[model samples]
Target: MYVRSQSDDIYGDVWTEEKAYCVEVEVHRVQDAEDLLFSPWREVSWTEKKREELRENLTLYKPSFEALSKVRVLLLGPVGAGKSSFINSIRSVLYRRVSLLPIIGSVSEGFTKKLKCYDIRAEKGGQPTALTLCDAMGFGDSEGTGMTLHDTLAVIKGHVPEGHKFQSEASINFNTPGYRQSPAMEDTVHCAVFVLDACKVLSYSENLEKKLKKLHRMISDLGIPHVVLLTHVDQVCHAVQEDVQYVYTSRIVQERMQKAAELVGLPLSFVYPIKNYASEVSVNCNTDILLLSAVNQILQAIDDASEDYPSAPQEAETKR
Candidate 1:
């Protein structure tokens, strides 16, 4: 039998007994595993000052061209992907309170049924910012379950109007009520955001995959810039759940973000991992920072896409 003790060679073997046997053992420090970090895969400032800076930037933002009044962003995704919740979160951050203007679903399906447009403000009763978030019915994984492709395309083309309830079995056309036969440049979507649950990125169904692929192609053909938001990121990594500041330092979260980017066929830079204000009663500095960062990137993308925005009917006629 041999005994172990603290020594200069903690990793050295212990020798004992008449047979002169040596048992090799290695010592490991607890701090070694605790100190393991991914070297901050992404850089983000988690301070109230940064949050206010982002808020000011968004408040002062405007469309690149004069024809457009506001940057219209369309939110699209599968059921329970937090599309509505994301809108509410943004409002909550901007208002510095818990805003639930958009209905969030509690079940496995989407809660938003109509094409609704939300005008955000930097403060309550303040002037509307130069941005609008349009929410639509989530895409389902089965036939005739969620928003139809035709309706989605029509919405992108600026044909559908606000408050138009989506019919999974029917597609929007010129004959539809309140259809904008000639939608202005400000009515169309400048950017398309595809929200996905970070935890379910790998388990997407075949039907959902096909629908996403088709939507991606269609949106690309329309020349509208698209991005993917991987929500519920706190649920994906324990480290991030404990402290959102560790989002970039957690390897698990980074891997999930990479997988989400791959699933949506977008570049790594085009994908953002966000934690919606779920179960939280008040605003959080870190959460607000992450959400604002995503919004800032989205607005930047919209400005980039605005360079190629289709000319308005009047502008086209005038130019000709």
Candidate 2:
């Protein structure tokens, strides 16, 4: 909330006798809906041409069959970590909001509110396989203790098998039989997109590192390369002289961040950061670009998903 005095509102006219010099600059109040999901408001002379041009080059993500069909990403995070919201953000990114309605009563909203997958091809669109970006139930260890960890894990696991490498003792359960899904309104989350709130309290919370490490180990063993989404970074990095790129100053924050990364184990590289809101316009953030800093990392994983396809691959003509 920035305040301006009445006098400051009016600009000084510098000896304007030739032409009437009246250039008005105003501040208008707008809501989160009006503002682009990942855009920061800035000042500019109102010109229709400029507006249209800006829209053309904008890298906005709107949910649409076109974009959705091209890739499949699974949203994974601790409970209340904004998994659903991020899924919505993806819809926004691909410009397919209208087409992406939560198929009413399809997934039993009261029991399991899942958006039906979009088959870009069926609608005279491109691909045959519909893209599935899953929003997995959060693994927050239950804000409620009455709920035992085992039952919660059962639901959270949601068809994602416990790979043989990690939980060797427990039988593998909760796997969506690889590809070729059933016709009965199925939503399979391929390739988990795990979220970590950048603003969450850092420092010692015993076993957090261990839990995160286990999660990472599981991800690696599952043979699914993942995208690490570190969100709400603006709240953590705003006040400091250090930029969002350097939010790891505090040793405590860094340690926790490291733990999150380590979870993915060796071979995987990099963590991505995003400022969740466009309340303020700054070079450090882009309100119109949900996690722009992390987009490259995400696309990399998406492109790599070809490796995980369940179908047998062509034997690259074995030359004698």
Candidate 3:
């Protein structure tokens, strides 16, 4: 008992009961598409000037504590969440070129297997910046895959040595080769970033959700500042795909970002949407600006956490 509208002619008069229902749903969806493009939920400057400001800020950033020469940041997330790609994007923005120092894997595979830290430089062959990005294997939903909980904790504590390959069944311990029994303060992670796929936020499996929650609790106990980088935003909303600046305004993207925050047990402000350079031939200003903004926020978070440390020269000098 269905009456066809003028738009229903697109089906070519061969509509069955199921087809009729689908067509009706499609009609309503198309009619309401405009509603999904909400007003600017978050304000972000999408201009070249803002881009320059962010870039310069990151380039000139220095740790508040003089004892530490560089601030270490650890990237953590589920498999194929663009952790390596995000690093490359940051490097590209800082270096002003398409830099691919970190090896990237397919959407379902993890390419980074070892615990390695990368020193970012503002220019090629120039002095490294004050920021060090540490890359590690992605976390898996199952017990015997990806990185183990112990290994993650060890890395945060600065005990795991560089170039240490992650083991599926075991974690690096005191007897492990090249392990740092007493790591310096500068070696420890000042910030932890959890990169997640925007499209998969709502679709995460039960096991994956449980794993993330557990990790969140452990990281929280350490009192380290953490944030979530919601990646692959372009794939989630059409408006964002057409224009990267439309990320915060798109209702779908905002909702997904909120869900991502809840998934990681962090505040909405801590969840940032980023689009890594996946298949681009060259860098774009909009993309660079977003990446720089995320890095700027991370540095701010690191500074906020450093405020609690003792200011005495003895403790600072010894820790360094």
Q: Please provide TM-scores, in order, for all candidate models, with all chains considered together.
A: 0.86, 0.48, 0.85
Off by over 4 Å in 1: 1-36, 310-320
lDDT of each residue in 210-290, candidate 3, tens digit only: 777788887766767889999999998887787789887778888899999899888899999999998886889999988
lDDT of each: 0.83, 0.40, 0.83
Q: Ten-residue segment with the worst summed lDDT in candidate 3?
A: 19-28
Badly placed stretches (over 4 Å) of model 3 are: 1-38, 107-109, 311-320
Candidates 1 and 3: which is better by TM-score?
1
| Cα lDDT of model 2 by residue, 1-320, tens digit | 23333332347543335334346656666522221223222222234454334333223322232223344455555544455555444333334222344422212112122322333232224333334454433443423312223332332333333221222223234453332222111222335566777656354244444455565565554454566776665554432223333333333334444555655443324565544422332222223233433444565564465444432111111111
Model 2, residue 89: displacement in angstroms?
A: 2.7
The predicted structure with the larger TM-score, 1 or 2, is 1
Model 2 misplaced stretches (Cα beyond 4 Å) = 1-70, 93-131, 142-189, 201-208, 239-259, 263-268, 278-285, 290-293, 305-320
The best candidate by TM-score is 1
